[model samples]
Target: MTLYYDETGDTKLPFESLSIAETVIQGTLRYLESPYDAEVNLLLTMNNEIREINQEHRNIDKATDVLSFPAIDFEVPGDFSDVSTFDLNPETKELILGDIVISKEKVLSQGDEYGHSPLREYAFLIVHSVLHLVGYDHMEEDEKETMERIQKAIMEYLKISR
Candidate 1:
């Protein structure tokens, strides 16, 4: 799997190290039980930058902790047990999973508000975003709970506590 990471937020705040972040992302993918090789981008951005992106892509006016733009439009059975059944990227020969945009400012503030370390919050968001990239949503109560359960399980797997 290829994880392309970028940052565009305040540089002063000590963000999660790239290696740790990559591990968390990879752990999330593994938690999904997917075996397909994939490529994804994780963008750590600022509030305003994310707000602009949210407006442009989702038509939402405010900045969110994370946003996912999936490359494909399909869902797999349960934690992606059948991920290999999905189509592959013709050129890359990898599953073009998608992109994840995270607001660093939100991460900082939410980490403080939620009484968790910024790194933990970052890991949580990465897992949440990956779930979305793999065709998970929270449009309903049941779906939301299911996604939350998976996210919590992944965070636990990463040993990131609240």
Candidate 2:
């Protein structure tokens, strides 16, 4: 898995030594057993910027912890059987999973509020967003249960706990 990472925010991350965000992302892909080599784009931004993006895209008018824009619409979550040739990157032949935007401010605040390290919160968010990229969603109760279960498993796999 390849991660294209970027950061755009005045608020720096609370934790200084957590490059494990990349590990969390790759771990998610492995946990799902993605059929093809995959790449993801990640952005670390501030709350206000994410809020504006959320408002523009989702029209929710609120700051979110993370947002995912998936490149493929799977017939079933994590089922890559139907992937097409078009989904692959021409140069690298890797599946373009999609993009993730995270709120750095939320990573700090939520970690403190939830009584966990920022690293843990950051890892959780990365896993959550990667699941979204693979077509997992929580719009319904059953789906929520499944997604949550998978998330827990991946977190355990990565040895990251709250």
Candidate 3:
């Protein structure tokens, strides 16, 4: 698995924290039966940066905790074998999963709001974003339940609890 981090304008966040996130992400991918040759880009930035991104891409003015931009389009709870057909990076020859942009401020704030540790929230967000990268969504009730179940299971598997 290949993981990339972009912190062009962030100051308060520790870039080293992403190493744990990468582990959680890889664990999730393995749990979901994704190919070993997978790549994902993670962006950790302030709320303003994420707000601008949310506005530009999703037409929302407020900052979201995380946003996933998937490279492969598939049905929710998709098959991993189909993932082999996704776009690959020319140099690395890895399946480009997609991008996950997370707001560092929201992670801290939401962790307090949700009564979970910052580490748990961070790992949860990484797992959630990985699901999105693998064509999982929770826009509806059933989909939300399924996604939540998988997320909780992955979190449990990683021994990352709230």
Model 1 lDDT on a 0 to 1 scale: 0.80
- lDDT by residue (1-162, candidate 1, tens digit) is 778888885543465456766788778877776677678888888989999999999899998999999876655523445445345767777777889998888888999999988888878888888888888889999889989988888888888898
Task: Give a tens-digit lDDT track for model 2, residues 109-161.
Answer: 99999999989899999899888888899999999999999999999999989
Count of clashing residue pairs in every prediction = 0, 0, 0
Task: Give the candidate order by descending lDDT.
Answer: 2, 3, 1
Poorest stretch of ten by lDDT in candidate 1: 77-86
The candidate that achieves the highest TM-score relative to the unseen native structure: 2
Regions of model 3 farther than 4 Å from truth: 8-15, 84-86
> What pairs collide in candidate 2?
none
- Candidate 3 local accuracy as lDDT? 0.84
Residue 105 displacement (Å), model 3: 0.4
Which candidate ranks first by lDDT, i.e. highest? 2
Give one digit per residue, the lDDT tens place, for model 3 in 1-162: 788987645445434567887799889988887665788999988889999999999999998999999988866465766554437787888888899998888888888999987778888999999899888899999989999999999999999998
TM-score of each: 0.89, 0.94, 0.91
Ranking 2 against 3 by lDDT, winner:
2
C-alpha local distance difference test of each model: 0.80, 0.87, 0.84
